[model samples]
Target: MAAPEPSSPAPDLPLLDEHRIAIDAPRDRVWAGLCRWSDTLGIGDRHPLGLLLGTQPRRGFERVELVPERVLGFAGRHRFSRYRLTFELAEITPVRTQVTARSNAEFPRLRGRAYHALVVGSGAHVVSVRRMLNSIRRESLKD
Candidate 1:
């Protein structure tokens, strides 16, 4: 799959959450850290959601796009929702990079709306995503 363009709209899916962080590390290092951390979380390129999706290695996410040290993306679906998460990296200076994590998702039907309220409205998704971004910053800055 291809990574969705950053400036482009997410089509029918709405923007669920977005977070940005500036890391005091090289682009390459941040890219590596992103891969490693996402992999360890078992959500890298695996379809680990369930049988409705596929029995893959990681969690519910599958890496749908990659662009070396620049862009990384993932998409997955369950009974209630279809979603995408994209991480874009831009070099601010030789020693710094800005990382933005964006999530777009569509929740269908009554059940799906309830699920959305439970996760998004409760702010759990924001906390989790922010923590993940921070973890990448920490890991990337490591020696």
Candidate 2:
């Protein structure tokens, strides 16, 4: 069967956003560290949303969708959206790994666009998601 369609409109924001970094450590070491839920815990400090949502404590995986060297998907909560965020490992080479996050919530529209336009943007949400992605990358590297 084909995948189901999304209910909401394609987020007016960038969806498949990504960042690539060359960690000082080897890919396996980085992958090992990245794979752990503990590594992700409290890493929100770098995220722009983190500043607003605060740090999330380490919680064990309630469900494990996929696990292996090449890909890993799981459900967990973050500070802003209380939804399951999936991290997909796209590429894992000896030198580096590529990962992406996918989630859709009205929080961005609420706290981000709607709030900003009415209060800050005049009618548009000006929050920079690129900055958020960069923050995630920085936090990921610290481990």
Candidate 3:
């Protein structure tokens, strides 16, 4: 099925992070890794639950946009937070590509604010995002 409409924050949401990596593979190969959930949890944008809306916690993000090798975006929210993650690709060379992962999110209410504090304020989120980008780079380079 086609991905849902492009996803973005409500403008009031904060910019969580913007991480970039240069990969040896071409954009197409890198794009494949963007679509992979296990391979890149940072870009988990294709799970069925991501699109299904309910009060139940969601394990993944629904695809909000796809532009071939240029962009892949998704948004999903659980009880504590609502967030959007986007991977933007740029061709650096015939055999190389640059991928940037940008995240925007908001944690509302008292509990949500606390959840954000524990997760985002602890530096864990940044570390995990970097690790995820590296994982994608490694996965894409594999033969």
Best by lDDT: 1
Candidate 2 is scored at a TM of: 0.39
Error of 3 at 75 (Å): 0.9
TM-score order, best first, reads 1, 3, 2
What is the TM-score (0 to 1) of candidate 1? 0.80
**Candidate 1: residue 110 Cα off by (Å):** 0.4
**What is the full ranking by lDDT, best candidate first?**
1, 3, 2
- What's model 2's overall lDDT? 0.42
The predicted structure with the larger lDDT, 1 or 2, is 1
Per-model CA lDDT versus the true structure: 0.78, 0.42, 0.74
- Give the alpha carbon lDDT tens digit for every residue of 38-80 in model 2: 2443343356655554423234222334455444433333433
Q: In candidate 2, how many clashes are counted?
A: 0
Cα lDDT tens digits for candidate 3, 1-143:
46566544343468988999999999888878766743334222446544443322244556677777788777767777888877898999978999898988888899888978988999888997798789878777767
Of the two candidates 1 and 3, the one with more favorable TM-score, higher being better, is 1
TM-score of each: 0.80, 0.39, 0.78
Candidate 1 residues 40-98, lDDT tens each? Answer: 55443534446544423227666767898988877767777788788999999998999
Mark the 10 consecutive residues where model 1 has the least summed lDDT.
3-12
